[model samples]
Target: MNYTLTPLGDRAIVIELGNEITIATHNLVQSVVAFLDQHPFDWITEYIPAFTTVTIFYNPLLVLPKTNQTTSASPYEHVVNELIPYLDNLEENHSELGRTIEIPVCYGGELGPDLPYVAEYHNLSEEQIVDLHSKGDYLVYMIGFAPGFPYIGGMPEDLATPRKDNPRLKIPAGSVGIAGNQTGVYPIETPGGWQLIGRTPLPLFDPELEPPTLLKTGDVIRFKPITKQEFDSYKEDKA
Candidate 1:
């Protein structure tokens, strides 16, 4: 339940739960988000959860007249005071377990142009790279950058690689890539710097769907390698 409250702009307060990007910090962030979702303040606008921080944005107009010291106390101070009590007992509120999702990926060739680069970078064969990547137990740390894009963690250190010096202009949706110690799938075609290693046939983003994002924060992800033929068949089935 250890945290610090800092003001963001005029109407938002950032609650920093921890300093690291470990599972412990992720849990704390989730706990705080869950608490706010269940017991939302009327003056609050929205809350954004990150690796180790949960930013709470508020409506100052709604909070102005409600503060005890309306003449002196700012909305930020009032909101901080109100939030401290709830956060002090936050450790008691545990978030529910995340859902495990299996994603089938087709590695190398046209879909994954950078697979060879990654293999060379690690001084391993392409098959070895695929084996290590597919066997990893990943977690969706957050949904960000682009709509439905999942910033996944838990990539093995052996597969670690730096991003491209010159980013690609338009990476296709479902293109899986590695950047630093993390791995992720591009939910939509966009410019990126991550080294592409594979691609999934799954449609990760659909604006018309109830929940547009295929993955959510705290979800578990398992990469399953698929053959080129199998990847084509999967896409055809979905189409």
Candidate 2:
């Protein structure tokens, strides 16, 4: 599907791809990301890719006017026009699949406070809940809400569950949860409403890390179930 570009405030431009959230739209978004990064304008500051759109941030003052054309009224329009040619000629990105990162989660009990509730909601056993979550291969569609938080896709329909009626005041970092047709984890101590299934031991956000955020758009994530004993062991090892 073709995309339309619109000015987002004064410093950003939002490209609207197809409204549907499918693999095709996501790939197209990534292709846009790849092209922008490869052929970057001097004023371009950053590119934020969501499920089906990429919002580009830039500096208006630094944006060099097109050499061959007359000055335009809106810098955003000029930027959009310059971008159109690159997108129009973009080929489908045939890059290899992203590396699958396995996250070990301690399922049930306190770590997964909503596990029993979720199982009952679907007439499923807690073991079945664990199996369904661990077996699914999730794709990182975007990182939003909280820092390092990943909005993932690819959960099987049968295991889909709704969010908590009342969200907790604070969900701890690494709390794995499902809401409606989507599933994700809380990267930091943040308020959220997704059904809690487990908790990962990793600190998804770290101030000392080179790129602070652990996951990125287009990454693949898979959960691995671990016993409480294993969870403690892993934590101690990291410590």
Candidate 3:
């Protein structure tokens, strides 16, 4: 992985991780995070990590000496130059981190209004569709589009369905869906077009909970097909 540190001001530097975010790439992100946690860099105020980049916020007033204020040199520039060498030496080490989560999904019927349509479109039985969707391993890319919404990859190529012709006005939270070559869980109820397969009782996002997101980037996921009764049971238990 390559990194580019850009100074936002005297107080912060945004580091861009020039690599695709994957389970294999998490080590680099973790390393940078670890460094920030231990290092007493008074200039740094915040750190935000995305798919393949981390932005660092800092304060110039804290890092610069009061006496050095006489010079026209920017403290940010000085810090960037000093950090460049260290960043250049950093290796691309991936974290051995990833968790597989089994999610129960009730397909067809009211839960999956479009399941029959999808099955017919692919000239396959609905059961086959369910099996195909549930059999594969999915990698969490990033949580976006809504809170706890996990953008996952690694769906079977055959299951690469497109968005609906007419998007629904409301898609329930915990709705498992597929769009194009990807699939995801809706963290909150909102309008969406991905083919709804089932609804899980698990809360994907809860503001009151610490680390509210159920799935994080770099985690692995698997779907387990369940009957409507099973889904109902799970929901009741959760409630």
Q: Which prediction has the highest lDDT against the true structure?
A: 1
Clashing pairs in model 2, backbone N/Cα/C closer than 3 A: none
Of 1 and 2, the candidate ranking higher by lDDT = 1
TM-scores of all candidate predictions against the true structure: 0.93, 0.93, 0.82
The alpha-carbon lDDT assigned to residue 228 of candidate 3 equals 89
Backbone N/Cα/C clashes per model: 0, 0, 5
Compared with the true structure, model 1 gives a TM-score of: 0.93
What value of lDDT does candidate 1 attain over all alpha carbons? 0.89
Cα error, residue 6 of model 1, in Å, equals 0.3
Question: Model 3 over residues 1-239: C-alpha lDDT tens digits?
Answer: 47777766556677877567565555676566656667746677777656666667767676666667766767777667656776677666646557888888888889888888888888999999999999988877666778878877788988778899999999988888888888888889899788887777778888988888788766788889889889888888878
Q: Tens digit of lDDT per residue, candidate 2, span 79-162? A: 877888887778766355566889999999999999999999999999998999899789998889878888888888987887
Q: By TM-score, highest first, what's the ranking?
A: 2, 1, 3
Ranking, lDDT, top scorer first: 1, 2, 3
